[model samples]
Structures are given as structure tokens and as C-alpha cells.
Target: MPLQPLLALTNSEPEEVECPAPAPAPSRPLTAEEYFSEQPPEGDIGRPRHLATKVQKFKATLWLCEDYPLQLQEQIMPILDLMASMSSPHFAKLKDFIQMQLPAGFPVKIEIPLFHVLNARITFGNIFGTETPVPHVQSIEEGDRISAVIDDACFAIPPGYKDATALDDRHCGLDDEEGLLQYAIQQSLMESGTQDDQVDVWEALRGARPVTPSPRSASPNLLNSEERQLQRAIEASLASLSVGPQQAAPAPPPIEDDLQAALALSAQEHSRLESELMEEQRALDEAIRLSLLDK
Candidate 1:
């Protein structure tokens, strides 16, 4: 569906990046072809990337939570849906965010909370596309830095939401958001079913849970009853993996001149890759440009 960017009016969150609604209006999320294709749609303005959050220290753990002004969850949900439809090299930020867990020495955690959007507006022509270098998707390093900023913001609970009394008296406002973030994290950990004493909140946080690999035959059987069937299955699988043509290897005991020839071949290979890389970069740029277009 077309996504509308909400504007924050009051001094609620520290810093928020809100996109201006495009002309003709986007009624749905950008298609993968559009998101990755060349040229922005007719009206897309740009994707805004800004860091905004609030922090609080409750007992031993430090809560690192975003103060989102949009009740629609514009920060993460749309990106997630886009990720579910695309592959590698696209929507990589969402992928990396899912894998990020709080590290030791910081006593940090992540939670989602909300605020209100007082009003909204639309900006004229795409400000970014007209520029020499229109903005592109963030790199892994840039994404990591933003993640770190969200994690490190907690020096202390903001002015009021410190003691239990503050929490008890909380209402549906900014302070409530802060408490909600902390409470959400606590609830998640409690639901994990770890014994209360076992989970020292200050200890290093957990990483994504590991997935079990499917079982494979540990040892091949030569004379078992199913040996014939196993051999046929293996042969069929191998046949399906036949690759395209490849250069034959040189003789094992290669001569000095042969090595020199191989070096020349390697140099030629590098030159070919360099050309391919330039084309790829050009295509990537076009894709980013078009992604700014309205869906």
C-alpha cells in the first residue's frame, strides 16, 4: 500500500527523519522491480534516514528504544515487508538489523514504542535526485554506526521516569513510551522461561538463536540393503548440479614459463572483472535513483 510519512509537530523525539508525501500519491509499497530497477517512479521524493531514540537505565539493564512519532510503525514494518519480497543486495539494512543483538559491556536492549504525529505535508520535486549524487542505500558500516547510536544513548533515565513512582503515575505520553520500551524488553526476557536467578540482566545479551541443520548420512554404505537406492539418489543429485563449461587445469608439475603465463592470465581476468564492476556500479546507481519515485 502507498505509505504516507507522518510529520512530528511538538518537541517529542530527539531527532526524526520523516519523508514528504509524493504527488499522485503512492498507494502501495514500491515493487521489487521498481525498488531495484532504473529510475524513480513519477512522484517518489526520497527515503529519509535519520537516527532518533530515547534511553533509560532501570536497575541493571540499559534500554535503547526508538521514540517513533508514527503510530503506523513507519520505522521498521514497511522495510520488513519489502525485505520479505527481495533478495541479497537489496533491503540489506533490514537484514542486518534483525541480526543485531546487544553486546556485553553496554548492558543494552532494543524495544519499540510510539508517540503522536501532529500533522503532515508534501515537498515539491525530489530534492535528492536533482543533485549530482542522489542518496543511496546505506552501507554496512553506516548501518552499524546507526545501530550503535541507538544502543549507546542511555546515560540516565530522562528527567522524570526514574523511580517506581514515576512508572506508577505514567499515562499515555512520552514517559509512558519510555516505560513501555523497558517493560517490553523485560516481558520478552521473562517469556523466554529462563529461571529468574539464571538470567543476570547485566550479563552479555544473547545472539540470534541457532538453527539446526538437516541431517545427512554420516558415512557412506557400500554393502547395505539400500546401497543401490542410495547410489542412485546421489548420482541423480550430482547430475542436477552439473555446472557450465570451465577452463581445464594446467598440468600439476607446471614449468616456470607456465607460471608466468598463468600470471598473465590472472592479470587479464582482473581487467575483465574491473569492467564488469563499473557496469554493476552504474546499474546500482540507476536503481537507487528510480527507487525514490512514488509507487
Candidate 2:
């Protein structure tokens, strides 16, 4: 019986046991909620308004990593998201965006978000300190500068927003919503200056001077917001002339020579004046003495 069982085993070939390959996973479609909810690892959601402020400036830092630093990349996500989301609502009409012939292909999708809080109907006088209503857009005559404030909300966009669409041609194209907003703001700012008694806001901010309205003038507010921006840019350029990248550092102060020269001049003047004063005093005393003697 044992020999018969061994013979049967020897004649039979091992059964082929085939394991089926695992099926591929189906990709889930990305929903709008998911796109917006994907917060940058640093949690940039609640503080966009603060981030929008250009006050806390930082010098650019260079890195040579093959991959972007996790920290730096994470920092820009919220800004990008904010810009993308905000522009979506107002400029969604591609009619203009298309005619603009955005550099990137048509139907370009910007993954970023716009700042919701920053969007508002910005009227000139409505925003500035005095609420001096700016004349209607039509009322603005050509070449006349107008004075207006960026509605509090317009100023609410975060500075890091520039980082979001930097790489996207579609987003970077002038037709994109961000570009349109920038163009509009720059235009508005420019139009305010030289539009007749327009206040130079760039100067006020830079010089830390209080803003005062310029007197009305016959000059048309010809300069668009873009032109105004250029003016500011020029001013900024001029302001930096003393410390430009190309300029050489000034030689050390001529401290010793200046001090010695000042001292020498002071001494010479002091001696000359002292002698003259003494002579006058002596003459006065002699006259007083003679008067007393005569009396």
C-alpha cells in the first residue's frame, strides 16, 4: 500500500496554482471643495489679510536644492489658492480674457484662489480718509488726476499672491484675473495723480507724510492707473539712487579733517570778535569815566 501511494505521487505533476494580478485603482475626480480645502501644510487659511500686507518685507533668499524647500513651497500655496479663488467670480467671463489672447492655451485653468474679502466695488471717495466721493469714472476728464483710496478690501490681497501664478503662463498672461485686477488698480492709482490737484500717494507712503488732496486743475486725468504706477516706480527708482545696486559705497566720513577745519574756523572767528569787543568796551568805559569826571 505504501509503495502504491509513492508510485501515484511520482507519476502526477504538481498542479499549477496561478494567482491573479491585482486590479488597478480608479482615479477619483477632483472636486472644487477638495481643491480649496487642500490647505498648505503651514495652515495659511485664516491669516490671508495679514499676509496681504506688504509691510513685513523680507529680502530674497536663494537656495540650490534640487527640490524646492518644503517650507518655501508650503508658504506660497495659500496665496496661490486665494488668488485663484478670488478672480474666479468676477472675471470668469472669458470673453475679455480670450480677446486678451492670454499667452497660454485657451480654457486655461488657474488652480489658485482670489482673496474673497478683497473684492468690492471700489469707489474713489468711498475709500479715502475723507470719504470725498471721487467723481464717477465718466466724470473723470482726460489727463486730469483724481484722488481716491484703495477700498480697505482692495488692500487686503496678500503679497505672497504674486508667487501663486508665477509659473503658470495661463495665469501669468495679461488676460488672467489677477493681471486684470493689477491693471485696474494700477490704472486707478495712476489716474488719481496728475488728474488735477491729485495727491501723490506713493510719496506720502514713502515719505511718511500725511496725504492732502491737491487742488483741482484743468489738466485731464489722462494718466491711467498704469501710468501712475510707472510714476511711482520712477519715484522709487530715484529714491534709491543714493543706494542703488550699481552705486559704490560712500567713502568713510571725512571726520578728522572736518572736525579740525571746523575747530580752526571757530577759533579764528572767536579771537577776532573777542578783540573787537574788548576795544569797544574800553572806549565805552573811558567815555563813562570822562562823563563822571565832568559831572
Candidate 3:
């Protein structure tokens, strides 16, 4: 009777308790690749979550001279666009401004030039959306006055041009590279304006000129293929200019003397520029070496 009563009392068995399995220990410390592979949680990742949705607008004014050629302007616009679109670590701070203030898909866009004839201004609108267009010239009168000043200061006659209209559309095309070079030469000479003391223009031009191998011989060891090609192009351009239609009338004694002097000055300037360029190249190479060492 006692055995039956005990058995009947414990009809239900004790409930089994569940336990979690222990986490397996890593075989070794995770490599950098493995550690970075596991993505952080969305909330943990820090990024600009709230930004302005509307596109921002900005304007930049290029105070080019009134006589600045339309073809040059067209060429310049694309260059400006290219410069703006180029990626640079220097522009890191602009990231937030670009994302929040600029147009949604395009980070940067230099729109077509807007020529304001009344004020003689070229406006390049951008999506920067920060500052208003700077008023370089307040009125048409001011613009006219500025233009007059520039003309008087910059565009004087050189001994090379026998006719006053030589600088006009009749002489230099301003469309072709040779014409551009001639135009530049004329402009430099004009700016110098028979001032014996002023060698600034020639020196500046010489400094700005791209480095290329000598035209007489191909020094493959000295210059890269690209440089050799550039040298050839420069030589061809110069050759074309030399063989181009020339005035039949001989230059006067004084003009001829002046031309000879100019040529001599240019030769001296070229030698000085070459020496300076070599020094600069050495300095640049040293800087690169130091930077590599630091890295």
C-alpha cells in the first residue's frame, strides 16, 4: 500500500532545464582583413544623416579684358571645368558643403559662361551655393573706364608691327596655335613697349614655357617620349611661323637694330631660364625623395 501511494504521488517527472552552448574560442587573433570584413552596425557608422535636399547656387566672375577673344574664352571655359572637376585631397573640407549644399547628383559643375555685355563681365555659375557673385565693376561706365585703362597700359605698338592693324584680325588669327603664339609675342613686346629696362615679360614667358628636348637633335636619353613629342610640336609650330607670309618691305635701321637686340635678349633669357629650371627640377626630385623617406 505504501509503495503504490509513493509511486502515484510522483506521476510527473522533473522538468528539464535548457542550457546555452559555450562560444568557441578563436583559433588565432583575427587578421586585419578579417577584422575589417565584419561591417559595423548602421547606427554605429558615423555619417551625415541629415543634409539639405535643395540644390545650392554660386557665381564666379572672371574679369577678362573686353578684347579677350571669344575663341579663347571657349577654350578657357572647358579648362576651368576640367580644373573644377579634378579630385584633390586639398578639397576634403568641401565634402560636406558639396554633399549638403550642392546639386544632388553632381558634386561640381561649371556651367557655360554667361557674358554680361552691359558690364563687360563673364560669369561662371557653379553649384557651390555659398557666396554671391562679386561685383567687380559696378556700372558700364566703370567697365568702360577699366577697359580703356587696360588698353592704354597693355596694348602699345611694338617695332615688329609696321602697320597699326597688324594686331587686328588681319594679321593674327588667334584661332590657331601659331597665331596664338604670335599674338602672345606681340602682346609681350607691346607690354614691354620699348622700355630698355623692362625684361620682365620675356623672363616671365621663358619661365612659363614648357620644358622640351632641343629641336636640332633627338636626345632619347635626356627626354621621355612625351617630352620629345612636345618638342616636335613646338618645333613645327615655330617652323610654320618662320615660313609664314612675311612683309616684303625691309624693316628700318632702328627697327632692325631693335629686333636684333630683342632676339639677343631672348637668347640670354633662355639660357638663364634653362639653368633655373634645372635647379628647380633637382629641388623637386629632392623633395620627392624626402617625402618617400617619411612615408
Leading candidate by lDDT: 1
Error of 1 at 99 (Å): 55
Better of 1 and 2 by TM-score: 2
Instruction: Kindly provide the TM-score of model 2 when superposed on the true structure, using C-alpha atoms.
Output: 0.17
lDDT of each: 0.38, 0.37, 0.37
Full-model lDDT, candidate 3: 0.37
lDDT of 2 by residue, 108-188 (tens): 122111232232221112222333444331223235343333445545667655432123332224444444444344344
lDDT (Cα, tens digit) per residue for candidate 1, span 1-295: 1111121122332445455554656677787898887886787534433455643211112343343222223445576567656544323533333344533322123221122432222112222233232344222234323221123334556785544212233222313444444433333344364314232222324433323221111122412322343334334334444544573332323223433233334334445767899999999998988887744
lDDT of 3 by residue, 143-261 (tens): 42322112342356666655321225513122454444443354345446531323334456566542332221233342243234333444444455466377333332332333334
**What's the lDDT for residue 71 in model 3?**
31
Model 1, residue 172: displacement in angstroms? 77
Best by TM-score: 3
Q: lDDT (0-100) at residue 244 of candidate 1?
A: 41
lDDT of 1: 0.38
Residue 110, candidate 1: Cα error in Å is 68
Query: What's the CA error at residue 153 for candidate 3, in Å?
Result: 30
